[model samples]
Target: MKKLIPISIAILFIAVIILFVMQCNVSKECAAPAGKAETPAIRADGTDLTIAYINTDTLLLNYQLSRDLNEELLKKQEDARTNLNQEARAFESEMQEFQRKLENNGFLSRDRAEREQQRLINREQELKDLNAKLSNELMVRQQEISSQLLDSITIYLKEMNLDKDYDLILSTTVGGTILHAKDGLNITGEVLDALNNRYKKKK
Candidate 1:
């Protein structure tokens, strides 16, 4: 579960980048701005297309909603682990008692002893199943949280661009497809601040 968090976050970043790219493609705004010899298309008014990027790693670290969601996930993982451990310990204690009884011939008959052993086996299987179920539930929950975060960011970006200020908004991460970008075009701080403000209001 601990390992899953970083993997999930990486996937989230990739998903966000894909979402933005799809939007740019749909709007036919993915082409390079004019003045470049290889430019594919230019605005009718001949103005340079505005572009901005958000550092997804930075956003995930500073965004209040993201931090809150991550903490929620950690809490859930911890709870599930603690519960499983308690059940396992209880089961072990019962098994030890059963072993002691069998060794001392405490059961009235062989059939009774066999029944107790079978019941323990069944209980072990039940515990295994429960562990698997909890893991699956946590995975599903992580995915839901990721989707929610992506949607929130997408909607905010769309709203921020309502004025058509940026023709393209890109998502960047450490060692991502975007290797280098001008600091001037980085809007991560602005975006993170707004997102945190909006999340606070919602809370």
Candidate 2:
């Protein structure tokens, strides 16, 4: 009995040492991301935005649906790009002509140079403004489409919550909260599928 007692005591001590070593090797996992992970999303105008982090599916479906609905807007946006390119070529041509006239000693009268420069500047500004307007319009239309799609997804998510029996669902907003998220938890693919199905029906 005495011999058995010493053996058991030594075995128990070894087991405890092994467990301690294992615990030391792994620190406790953090509940959320650390460091730069804390950064938030913000708009160009400095508006703090929030996106309830979603899965790739959500984005994919949203893109597919919007592409379907905004076919005309998409075409128009492309046409605007074509126009910008053409306008840029025209601007370059005019600039080259002005330079050539100067090089030929057909020196532009200060007044003519000023007038030409002003015309080019004005044309450049118009092109910029037009591009900005088209970009804004496209963005607005995209947001509108996203809003409509999210409305339905939000409803489905609520429904999913009720039946799936999750204790809680967590995600960060676009910028004010939740800068990063872990994999696995991202439901983007599932969301995309749902969105695709929804659009598939609408189509």
Tens-place lDDT per residue, model 2, 21-77, is 001112222223234343333333333332234533225325465445556456656
Q: Candidate 2: list runs displaced more than 4 Å.
A: 1-54, 57-77, 105-110, 159-167, 170-194
Per-model lDDT:
0.75, 0.50
lDDT of 2: 0.50
Per-prediction tally of clashes: 0, 12
Tell me how candidate 1 scores on lDDT.
0.75
TM-scores of all models?
0.82, 0.49
lDDT of 1 by residue, 91-183 (tens): 999999999998898999999999999999999998888888878877887887888888888889988887656777788777876788778
* Candidate no. 1 TM-score: 0.82
Report RMSD for candidate 2.
23.2
